[model samples]
Target chain A: MADPQGSNTRHQAYFRANLTLIGILLVIWAFVAFGCGIFLAPWLNQWRLPGTGYPLGFWFAQQGAIYVFVILIFVYVILMNRIDRRYGVDEKD
Target chain B: MTVQGWTFLIVGLSFTLYIAIAIITRARSTRDFYVAAKEVHPVANGMATAADWMSAASFIGMAGIISFLGADGAVYLMGWTGGYVLLALLLAPYLRKFGRFTVPDFIGDRYEARTARLVAVVCAIFISFTYVSGQMRGVGIVFSRFLEVDIALGVVIGMALVFFYAVLGGMKGITYTQVAQYCVLIFAFLVPAIFLSLMFADTALPQLGLGRLGDDGQSLLQRLDGLSTELGFGAYTEYGGSLINIAAITAALMLGTAGLPHVIIRFYTVRKVRDARSSAGWALLFIAILYTTAPAIAVFSRTNLLESVPETAYVESPEWLKTWEDVGLIAWDDRNGDGIITYAPGAAFAGKPIYAKDPETNEPLRGEFGQRLITNDSAGDHNELYVDRDIMVLANPEIAGLPDWVTALVAAGGLAAALSTAAGLLLVISSAVSHDLLKGAIMPNISEKRELLAARIAAGGAVVIAGLIGIWPPDYVAAIVAFAFGLAASSFFPAIVMGIFSTRMNGPGAISGMIAGIVFTTAYIIWFKFYDPSSNTPENWWFGISPEGIGVIGMLINFGVAIPVAALTRAPSPAIRTLVQDIRVPGDT
Candidate 1:
């Protein structure tokens, strides 16, 4: 079983790293979706986008946020694949 | 040929294509039936998943909602796509590594409790059934309108198509068929949208067209906002709902999207865990294509309705305007007897609108809303046009003066969206019954052949029930659908997340957390949705949380109950502990 105590410690460290990674991403998500999209939308609307006439908050809620969500998923995929390899758990294929 | 003949030809051809694909890829084993033998390419599965996920609501209903709801409609766009971030990160990869054919398989195995599994099963069936009923209803409506047949016959035709694909080829059949469906639907959606975008804004792309100034030198959205406020409705570009309601509603939809069994099951069809991760990105990319273009369609169609139909005397209205008016879907009262239709806010005018005329009776039928929906008010007639929201997508081509073929394509596209979702959902329901209920709980030693047989039978039975619900659609079907999303968010999401993330969560915690979430959320929905639907406004809401957002609270209560209950309970057994570690890693024997 590859030394129970040693593997257990290794597993805990891997788990903690994952949690930290996920925690950071989730905070970013909550900020863009809730903090910016809703609460700050009206306030941000005061400043019109330089090129686009849309208010900053309106832009964020409608288009900016979805683009960011896509970026976030890509980021997660790239980062987690790295993490998986580092932890020796990457997919075979 | 005529428009009706063209529509019949296109829709008929599309159904034939779907049926042929289903037969070509029929599933042999239980694995083939349930998870497509886990052999689908990530990108292809991504397309199939997109078709399955968009549903009639996304295709037929969303633009309609946006036409009326204005800025509030952004919630669906963000809510639907944003959920994929959660899914790709939180659930998909890990579930794929677990290598289960069904969601209940994961819950049952993870918690090491039959009851926990059963709860997940019940929630899966309930949510999928509610969702599928809406899809069936969508198909019936689309077919009936297109073919000019009885709605019930349309439903039967829809049911027969689903039975051949879903019950015959299972996931394998459904998968290939959905890829074809995605092509049909996206093409249908984009064509009318692109044409209108060019006509109005002169932009080639609908996405850019939405923000660009038209020939009149005003942005489409700006003009729409101006038009909306002039009629006393909220501004189109401005956010509509309260901040808290928007926050909660968006969160509920995101979490619910992530939790949906039909969507999650799609991940399992991919060959590797990595495919599961990347498939979500692709799925979102595909869905976002339609979702982003939808608002533009809404903006264009609403603006068109305002410009072309009105001002012209009813007798001189455009051909497309008369077409819808003939179907009793659009009505405006000429209260001033000027013979011109002036639509304004409902409360602005005292004139009541009546259905133009009953074809059979050659007399005006009572308007569907039955209150002279347009009323005899010339005072400030608030766009008193009773434009049925469902007609937005269906009628878009006609309104835009597009070719008849494009209109026919939209008809086929709507059918594709509804059929794909119905098939995906029926698969979930059947697996829940055959795999979870009969085999997992009742007959543990059932043969594989028998299980496969039971699955087909279960699927057929579910179609009948779902079709019946579609035919006699419940009074509050749409609201109940939102409630289904609520049920999913409150129950499966928390349970599955807890099981995977927390090694400390015992079966007891999982059980209690799910029960608490389901019971609380359901009671609130029942109270608001059934007991007193009239008082479902924010004031009557608990803490001003509307029923649409109540699931967020239910999710929190689940966490609240789970953490405490788990802390007090015995730790998960050592075997279960190792199972979690095993499930986390991919490419492990």
Candidate 2:
């Protein structure tokens, strides 16, 4: 009696959107921590960055990832807020 | 007073202050106990959260790990701090709007099913216990090393302090105490770091200090790279290992941090949903201060260590090195007969006397500086140096030859960092047992007074258990803590996220997904962590992923099982759907 099928479809859409955003973020996060930190490190080492004599990957592995993480938090906050509003679930106090 | 005596006195006073604060701010009711009456200011909560989150590992273990791992160690710096972004963006505000005191409450209520709540409780308990054990162990190590007390006694002292505050005041007591602890610990950590940086690079800020070129015109990293390469090791700044493994471990750590129970619970303490969002931003800012300094500490300490031992003779070794070696930290073998310490690569001294030979005399270097510093090498193995990674941060001030008080400050700072985290974890575990298990499940109709009593009893009991575990830790403190984070990421993160965002997620789906995730990940960890080593064959790891990286695969499985099973299950009743809508809207209160 509660339109179970209809609710199921709606829920699927929401799940897809949440998963998509999470997937995108995960890819970028991996690229910074793993890609730049380890795999691409050798390649990046060929090109020394300004000021710091080390490769970009070395910097990414240590300082760059942390800096990106702070920015990511702000980004996640904005994106999730938008998702919540679009889904009509934004808290209106 | 002697330097050690002064360290003991100052650190002891800080503990007394923490207890006094806890006693003055003891919670009055269940609401106050659980969420600090939801009256904490955003900035205040931010500071408390920062203190709560930056555990002993961050304060002491992180720099040491980085120093040893070289480039690979950045995974922790990125992974642990990155979770705050996930917290700020994905989970915090919605959970605050749902307005529950515990994470289990949100999961159970969101799915409108008791089973979902129970499953969440199990996950919370597992994660909290694993996490708390490491924190307690950290406390004991700091106490024994700095205060010169027996390890067991140190654990007991730490246990008693945490029990008094966590049981008496709950979140209210924990919150205020954390603020105090943060101030003490951060000041203790930064002062020595600043001094060391200035000494090394003439820069007060560690972040800039590390990048500043040394007096030789080569960057500090460039110098380190040359030193390690000369010693037959990878350059300090170069990365090694498979890309996939790095990605998996980093992802696992970040997700695990985001899903951590103690951190998520802090969101419920703020007054408004908006405040939760803002507090997260502030928490990250506070955390970044230390997060950024850690790498600098790693580079500076590694450089200093190499310089101190630079191809010198055993007799010429620095005083600090000798002291640390006496404490069983640094070890070296005089491979050749020459009294001069030869730190060169390969077995250049094979079949030769204990010390390397002098080029001119072709005889053992002898006399005061020439004696074999480390005498016990029966097998004559080539790798003759042993240095514990933990000593890097512990001996940083001493290594730099800073004043004695700076070293004392580090001792106190380490304790504060460890105790604050242990207290937070103990409180989380006790609350979950009392609020979720006893009150929510077994005694739903119990009075608030009884619940409060139960919570106190639970907190006391947890402290004892954690202290015992601390006395005899199963693994090194950092490895054990990393396993806990991996478990949280694989099991809890998916469930919490899906339950909040997806209306189709049924009780059965959430529970099964969690069970599957926990079972698969736990099995992988046990097999690789314990079983595989006994056989001595090629490690039968799944998909070439080590136990450390298995959490990423486990997380995928959790999402896979949860989404499909959720799709197969019938949707919730209309009443349940309305509850979801209500949770989404913040004004229901």
Candidate 3:
């Protein structure tokens, strides 16, 4: 338990940072999957995608949401990696 | 070569590759057997995880279901892929950091209770068993259709192949073979899709082709919507199901995907916590390649099918319809005595077509139009055809008049998807029994060598049982799939999330929460699905959530019970709190 006080505070800060990032990402996730894909689909269907015939909401549900999900995970990976290093808690290997 | 010859050659060669990989990468120790000695590259592991996660349902059933349901099918597309987001963000990295051989290992140790471990083992085994039986049956179906063999014989052959690799090489064998399987399956799926896209929309990419306009100045989807309504069905782009049900079912599937023991166990094969996150990203990317294309195929195939079948003379209908009809997946009943086929939005028969057969010769009876004669009465509708949803993907190439080899490739791809998922589930079941139940409890003093032997025996036993179930498959395979996802969501997802995220969640709380969740969801499913299926209508549903979506409520109940119980009870020991904290960070231990 060397310097338990300082390390505990640092760990707390790191955990809070993680929670905030996760919170923001989850909000975006819910918005795309539930918000645009389902609830607002009818409203968004008023407009078609530019040059393509797909309604915006239908595209999100069928194709766009999945693309966003993939990008979201990769974004998480990159940001989490930076956070890991910033906290000096990254894997040492 | 003919389609049959091509199927045999390709499927045979794929099996040979898998066996060779298994022999080369066979496990030599418990670590290798359980986690591939934690040596798998993230990309390779990603491919394997994708192969393991995408079953015959995703490969064969999804596109067909989407073709039939149209926009309503977005539930599966979003539900299945969206789960990876939850897994990567919430569960995968932390579980990998804990360095466990199995999901039960983490649950039992984290809760510091044998009962908690036992509950986890039971949930894992039950879920995996239910899921694997379906995969084996899928393999058997592919063989029976393409290879012209008995379904039981196909299952036996599949069992023998799986037993060799799973029992001999364990996770190490399954992982590498799955990488090869992923390649084979994706290739098989994409080739026909690309060909169809070019023929229909002048685009090689099916995803873009779905949205492009045809010569008629209407997109494929617009034409589909028009055709569907003209045939008395809902528009193709409009979701037909209740919105609440769709949202709830999607939630259940997403949470269930993250909680699946077979899927989560794949993460343990990676070397570090970061690898877990990165591999999940890769896995979803690989899966998205097929998933995104499946809906495109659905739209294209549905448009093609509607355009070709309805109003066509039976004698002159495309050869694919007759081919599928010969196999009993397509049925034509000239309900109005008209020579032309008329499809609409109603059941062609009360259930499956009861084909009229020659009693003496025991062969199917044929009508004047050379269509198979059926004994069943029509449902007073103009619909003359009863089409099984599976033909969308299976017969897409044939419908589009693509080469016979493309059709053959679909068969091999279905088999790869089924076998890979089956192998992954069997491993989880075996590890739960041999590792958690036996080594962790019944025989704690057992040596690693004996443990490894026990695991192999358990896997062998699991394969045989799964094969038997596949041969004499229950009529409720589709219904039981709902049970697997529902139980996994209700029982494992909440418990595991609480165990990792909540420092105060104790053994009593977890055990009670799991029991409550599983019982509530199982009873609800049984009540609606088995006990009184006629009452399964939306009007009778509790809050309009179907049995498929009841897992969402069960999860809420789990959280409701767990947090309160944990609050009233004593806090977890300091060591456990520290353990939770340790898993949250990616650092050298």
TM-score of every prediction relative to native: 0.94, 0.88, 0.99
lDDT by residue for model 3 over B30-135, one digit each (tens)? 9999999999999999999999999999999999999998888999999999999999999999999999899999999999999999888998999999999999
lDDT, model 2: 0.78
Model 3 interface RMSD, one decimal? 1.2
lDDT of 2 by residue, B1-589 (tens): 6779778777888989999999999999988888888888888898889899998888988898898778878678877887887787678877887888898898787777788788788878877888788878778777777777888888898898898898898999999999898888888889888988898778899887766766677777788888888876678887655566666777788889888899999999998877887889778878888988888899888888777775676777788777766555665665555544554434322332244447798754443543434334445545545666777888888888887787888888888888888888887888899999999899999999999999889889999988988898875554555568767887778888887777788877887787788789888777666666554223465666767777888888888888888788888777767666555444432
- lDDT of candidates 1 onward, in order: 0.85, 0.78, 0.92
TM-score of 3: 0.99
Q: Scoring model 1 with DockQ, what do you get?
A: 0.56
Worst 10 residues of 1 chain B by lDDT: B368-377
Evaluate every candidate with DockQ and list the scores. 0.56, 0.38, 0.78
Query: Which regions of candidate 3 deviate over 4 angstroms?
Result: none
Candidate 1 residue runs with Cα over 4 Å from true position: A1-7, B214-217, B309-312, B335-338, B347-383
Off by over 4 Å in 2: A1-31, A34-39, A75-93, B214-216, B335-381, B475-479, B534-539, B586-589
Q: Candidate 3 clashing pairs?
A: none
lDDT, model 2, position B578 = 69
Rank order (by DockQ, best first): 3, 1, 2
